[model samples]
Target: MNNYFNSNSVYIEEDFRCRFRMRRYVFERLLHDVQQVNPYFRQKLDRAGRPGFSPHQKVTVALRMMAYGSPADSMDETHGMSESTCLDTLQQFCDTIFQVHKDEYLRKPNQEDLNRLIRKAEDRGFPGMIGSLDCMHWDWKNCPNGWQGGFSGRSRKPTVVLEAVASYDTWIWHAFFGVLGSQNDITVLGRLPFFNNLMEGKAPQLHYYIKNRQYNMGYYLADDIYPKWATLVQAIPNPRNDTEKLFTLH
Candidate 1:
């Protein structure tokens, strides 16, 4: 911990971010928040009266395990923590983090959020666009043998898919993960639970105009792989005219 958090720390802030995946202040804030609710994160004494792991030590190990997908045993030597202890710390850390930040960071978009997203999209020439929808593949290094074939797609390797919707500012309003890689974008879209809100009439109402024609529903910009749906807009495959080409630019 002294190598980074001490007053005379050795490494610089850049090094901390490169290793921890967040700025030092951000990490400190997380540590503070986690400690506030979970006493397990606080430094304590063992039966022998020796000081146990400090808050920074525990939080750092947990972050390393998450950020780099490092195994629990890998931290036994570097951070002087046992494998069992590391696992427990990671679980507690994750639970505490979600408890602290879920309300703001993990929530679905509300009416006000929709308004802000629409205004930003309108400024960029897409008045009715809520966000861009996309999918990405994350390699599954430890996929079970029974499920490997089902998860392996064109990459010929076991993987999982993550679908996300993000506004112009890169604020992710929706995320759906854990779909098998074998599924294409269309298949993934069909399995998305996010549409349940829309189907149930629970989604926020939207109002916007394009060429003086008002639209009540918001749409997402997607790639050609997606089906042609009113809620999804795709660029022209072959833009023959300047107007079509300019429209594609947006």
Candidate 2:
């Protein structure tokens, strides 16, 4: 029988060495942030008789495997660990890393960040645009049987939702991921922490630049999918006539 479905012969290719090293570099950058929040990581590494690899090595290998979608056998072959050991280490690393960096990694933009962004947008004559919001779907390859039912919708495939906010220059300001694909754009937006800030006056004020004149408050830009909010300014649909198109062009 072919070994493709079997785990024994699974192995990483030699050509992937460069890829592995690059992944390790990315993981190292996140390690500082991870160590600050997760006490379990410190405790586990400090404990004696820990059969797995070093905490740093385990985290690096696991994160690389996840981020690159490498198989368990590939990780075992690359990192010189057994397949079962690689699996265990990956599970352990994910649990600890997520717990430690959950808040810091997932936090919404604060007032200061929003203020600076608004100022930058104003400098470019695109005032009142806090951020350009958009969503994308991440294809999921191995969703659990039970989860497949909930994860698939009209797309008929398992997918995770990702929403991002970007500036006029297309630099991402904030991003949230892992929402189920069944969710609509408005449903996802409603759950964003930034929305709460807007409602609670915690977000920075909206500024408008017209005719070298500056006006404060009263507008924001979002896709038409978002319901009208006191602070939101929705773009007009179609821009019906030429005059309307001219107004919409800016």
Candidate 3:
């Protein structure tokens, strides 16, 4: 008990919270959630008959590593786990979180979800708009030799693109990660699974009214680089009028 609890506050877990960068309650809740789905997260006795680290500690170290983008060895002081073990813990934690929440969290919109999105978007004066589509890059520190040149054209750094469609509330409805950085945004969009889902008629139907004009389809807010399409809404370039400026501003 003394080992896990701080000497100053036995009940509050002040030291734990400080090290984990989360409230004690949230840490415990995350541990409970993961324990239900992953056996690897469960605490166990070692082969030497010594008690191993608890599930919360493993998750805390992994979350800290990911949240801070720090190396595994950085957690040795607080987590007391070996660098190799920290990497394994992080891998297991990510896989378990995805397996448990993928159905509800990462899945595409359903009818009810679509309705909620439509309501939220309409309330923001953009009726029938689902989300903003954009691409972000993540640096690849260990990119392969053959791929490095291709991925490092402009930035001179190897990166992988992640395209996502995210709403005002930050709910991501579409995600296509791991596209090569060599491809432009248009090529990335063309090769993404989001378009394949649309082509296969797997996307949910959308209906909304814009300026009292009824529409049967929804659209996404994209930047100028995206191609002209029925489902894409781009801002007017160099607006010289109040209406166009206001439209672009909002």
lDDT of each: 0.85, 0.64, 0.79
The CA lDDT at 95 in model 1 is 94
- lDDT per residue (tens digit) for residues 168-203 in model 1: 877886788756544456677778888655444443
Q: Estimate each model's TM-score.
A: 0.88, 0.58, 0.81
Model 2 lDDT per residue over 20-107, tens place:
5543344555566556655434435325666535546566667677768778888666677677777876786777766766664445
| Displacement of the residue 245 alpha carbon in candidate 2, Å | 7.3
Better of 2 and 3 by lDDT: 3
Question: Candidate 3 on 33-73: residue-level lDDT in tens?
Answer: 89998888888999999989887678878888987787998
> Which stretches of model 2 miss by more than 4 angstroms?
1-28, 31-60, 87-105, 144-150, 166-181, 190-203, 206-208, 212-224, 228-250
On a 0 to 1 TM-score scale, where does candidate 3 land against the true structure?
0.81
- Each candidate's number of clashing pairs is 0, 0, 0
For TM-score, candidate 1 versus 3, the one ahead is 1
Cα error, residue 164 of model 1, in Å, equals 1.6
lDDT for 58 (candidate 3) = 87
Q: Report residue 234 deviation for candidate 1 (angstroms).
A: 2.5
